[model samples]
Target: MRIGINLLNLSQDRFGGVEQYITNLIGHMADSGENLTLFLFLKRKLKNVFPQHEKIKTIRFRKVMDSADVYDAIKKCKLDLWFCPLHRSYLPSVPVPTVATIHDVLHTEYPDFVPGGLEENNRYYGQYTASFDAVITVSDFSKSTIARQLSIPEKKIHVIPLNAPAIFDQAPAKITMKGVKQKYQLPDSYAIYPSSYNPHKNHLNLLKAILILREKYNTTIPLVLTGYADKSNGVYQSVLQFIRERSLEKQVWVLGYVPPEEMPSLYWNSSFLVFPSLYEGFGIPLVEAFKTKTPIVCSNKGSIPEITDHAALYFNPENPKEIALKMMELLNPLTRKQLSEKSSLRSRHFSWKKTASETLKVFRSVTRN
Candidate 1:
């Protein structure tokens, strides 16, 4: 089958879970000998992950002022199936089959999370609902949300859990401790919070928890913040303000954007990983933490409990005291070791090779008349 993977969202992103999913899927599909032709689109930031795929046919569409330019490109390609790995609400301009992955509906869960979020979220949801041949989601919770919000049948969506890179499940690099430590400028026994500065990530509460931890522990294990700060959203700015207001400039380090290769090392050097996201379809960072032997302190909200599955400590996202208490436990050597052990065990449940094989099965099942 001539499967066309939409490189639209993957093209534009600066390395996140969904982008990694697309890149991994396409790479694995190429190796699987499937006739998968990626409709490769380029954005300014995306590195060439599809360079070696002979089966992948790339079409570059300029970032036109009108969305119709993108529409015209897809229709003109005349693909038998369009696989959109990164979620967007692009309607099909042609009758050929289109499959999309909807990771989450965050704005619906926390409308106040970002500016103009609800309207855009609803607009995207309305446009893409039932238009695809099949929809893919990371968790059952998200499937129901999509079904209820979009008014699409639950059966119409496929549940494919997100996968981690082999690097995460692989052995940690034997780089010098000082090298990695100096790279992130991290002190001993610090915690990690790997996420964009989006509000639904609920980082403000993390700062509050950090303050609580500081008052209790009286140590400097900074909470490292990675990912792009969307100035338009004000989430990152609010976090900065909160830090300054509390004289936590030294306690919270905003490492604007870390390259992908450096991430696993950061995960290894940290004492533990904390994800206080208010909502998520699937917590990819938690899985990464698991794979890298990093203990976790994640929020009990959204699909975090489902995703982590009792592998890590959970706290109410809104409860700063509870979050701080979890961090305290995280800092304790024995408890951290136990959580890290459990993380290793839980990490086994996910893999990119398995995800790729499953995704291919879906393709065969759908395309076979």
Candidate 2:
């Protein structure tokens, strides 16, 4: 079957979660030999990142996302089906069937965390999702959330889980870790939290938990944060202020946005992964930590328990004391080692191949209907 993918959402910031999802999914789909011809739709000047294959072709548009050029380019492709991986419908009404992936309805669920408020979210989903023949979501939780938020039938939403990026499966060499540590000037012992400074990410609670670990429990290990930080956000400024007021200059290290090349070593060298997010469709970091044989201490909210199972230690994300206590438990070498072993086994449950095959089924089903 021939499929046209809306790739105009991808940007140079390849480290963005959704961009990584698109890149890895396309790569695995290309290698899987599913007898599928893919036409990638992107802006004209952007370099094509996917591999060149007889079955895969790049279609360039003058403008991307909600543009006449995007609709014209996609309509010209004349594919059997169209898939928009970025969760919204960017193209105009087309002759072929349409399937779009809605990662989550975070804006509707937590309106305060998102800008433009509920009215903006209503218009966003109303315009983008109304024409799709079918919808795809990352987890069962997200499927339900999107169904309620969009007032769409639950049966129309297909729940297909995402796998960790391919890089997480391989461990870095000890020398590579040492080099990375020296280059970043990272602390010798630290727990890594690789997420942006979004309000819903609940960074404030994580920082408070780290402080409690230091003062009350006397755990001197620093917390390493790696994600993009914009100074304009009040949350970002408040985080820095909290660090200063608490005298945690040495105990909290914020290394803004590590590249894809260095993420494995960063995960490999960390003691464990701490993801105290208040909400997530699916925590990709949980799978990454499991792949790296790094134990996780994350929130019990959303899909965390569903994804991690017994491989992680759970805590209420809002309670900093509970987060600290659970984190403290993982500090034990033997316990961490056992959890890490279990993590490798659990990581086997997810893979790019499985994700692609299941996604292909959805695409095929949409065409059949």
Candidate 3:
């Protein structure tokens, strides 16, 4: 079967979840010999590394394609279906079946989390949920919420849990901790929180939890925060203010937008990982932590429990005191090792191969329809 994909947003330097999903899925499908021909649609000049297969050919669109041109490509290419990995314009130009992945409903449910999202993103949520043929969500939480929000049939929405790529299962890089420390200027004995300052990630709560441990108790271990931070968001502003108010500028290391390559070491070298998201369709960091054999202190919200099981020390995401208590539990050696072993045990349940096999089933069913 021939498949056309919207790869315009793809990049090799992605620190976001959608980019990882697209890049790894294409690579795995290419290597799996599914007898599928892929035609990619991209508009940007970003660096791309698609699989080299006779079956796969990239069709780069010009800076813009008119409505007529988009339809022309759809019919002219004779694509069996068009797959938009991220949310694309919900209205498809051609009659071919359309499938799109909706990672999180945060933008719809919690508009405060996004920049002008309360006013701007509703149309996207409305379009994709109503217009798409089949909706693929990253978790059951999203499937249920999106179904209600869009008033779409539950059967039309499918829940496909995400998986860590082979990179997570691979051995650590040759770089030493000393080198990573110098490269990122990271300190020894630090706790790592790799999520961004996005409000839904509950960065404000995490910051408050860390401050409780440091300021209230004078715990000296530094907290390493790796994510993009813009001051406009309430969470970002609060985090910045907390650091200044508590005089925690030195205790907090905010490495805004670290590259994807260094993520593994950052997870492994950390004393423990903290992911107290107020909301997540699927917390990608929990799986990454489990794969890296890193201990996690994650929130009980969303699919964290479904994914992490008993592997993590759960905390109430809203109460900063609760997150602090969980964080304190990690400092105990007995609890630390227990969580470490359980994390690795739970991680074995998820894999890209498994994800691809299941996803391909959905693709096959959709094409037949």
- Model 2 residue runs over 4 Å out of place are 64-66, 128-130
Best by lDDT: 2
Q: Write the per-residue lDDT of candidate 1 for residues 229-264, one digit (tens) a residue.
A: 667758888988898999998778889888776788
Q: What are the TM-scores, per candidate, against the unseen true structure? A: 0.90, 0.94, 0.91
| Model 3 whole-model lDDT (C-alpha atoms) | 0.76
* lDDT for each residue of candidate 2 in 255-292, tens digit (9 for 90 to 100): 88788778889888899999999999887888888889
Regions more than 4 Å wrong, model 1? 9-13, 41-49, 63-78, 216-220, 230-233
**Mind sharing the TM-score for model 3?**
0.91
lDDT of 1: 0.77
Question: What is the C-alpha local distance difference test score of each model?
Answer: 0.77, 0.83, 0.76
| Superposed model 3: Cα runs more than 4 Å off | 9-14, 115-123, 128-130, 173-175, 230-238
Most TM-score-accurate candidate: 2
Which 10 consecutive positions of candidate 1 have the poorest summed lDDT? 38-47
How far residue 261's Cα lies from its native spot in candidate 1, in Å, is: 1.4
Clashing pairs in 2: 87-101
